[model samples]
Target: MTEQHAFSSKVLQEDCLDYTPFLSSVTLARRRAARLVSEWGHPDIAGDVALVVSELAGNALLHGRVLGQLFRVQLILTAAAVRIEVGDACGERRPEVRNPAQDEKFGRGMVIVDALATRWGVVPRTVGKTVWAEIDLR
Candidate 1:
């Protein structure tokens, strides 16, 4: 679903989708995020937004999946930035960045997010947590 909010006279556009906790949802989330960003007149940041969405959604699937619970992806757009948020039911399992060996094949999602996003963090919810990243449009 989509909604528009007004904050300090600026219109903030938001789109949210919930996905079943599955590996396939990661790809879906990435594609949807890219399309929404592009459609909102920010094609230049779509690629970066997609990458961030992929990482966050993948991390949610891998680390935040709870039985029978769905994860949510939300995109918030303003004049200056776009924020991507992934919320899952497993709140206790927080995400952390790992420095893996060069030969290691896993563990670099947050690093990629950190590099691309201007800022990112976790927000605790009553049932779960929302992991979010923001990319500046300037």
Candidate 2:
């Protein structure tokens, strides 16, 4: 039997945004990430991942409180899994998981992501932190 090739790709690097309003840029980045995953035969996972990226990136922009540091988003797919990575210049701060009541508005993002992601974590780089999540594709 012939072996099927795995797929992996890196985004062209988006420009960082000011931490004032966090809508347009975050949405755009999430869309691109979703599209990349969809091409790898996981459109279902893409939606959940899109939201995860949005929330993580949003937090980085809104709460991490850094300036002029463009974020990097990367997608990697293999026979067993698909991985999403979002890197920002907020190495000093790590993201915290929160639990909210059924009627609560905030703190729900990470909860949803945790439920969907097979694995997730925050990795510190020399200058920043990378928030990553992985979904099983099998």
lDDT of 2 at 70: 70
lDDT of 2 at 115: 79
Please identify model 1 stretches exceeding 4 Å from their true place: 1-11
Using alpha carbons, what is the TM-score of model 1?
0.90
The digit string of per-residue lDDT tens for model 2 on 79-120 reads 767676777787877766786787986777667777787777
Please, what is the TM-score per model?
A: 0.90, 0.76
Residue 12 accuracy (lDDT) in model 1: 77
Candidate 2, after superposition: displacement of residue 55 in Å? 1.6
What does candidate 1's lDDT look like per residue over 1-138, in tens digits? 112222232547899999998889999999999999999999999999999999999988988989999999999998878988899998898777789899998789999998898888888889999888888896
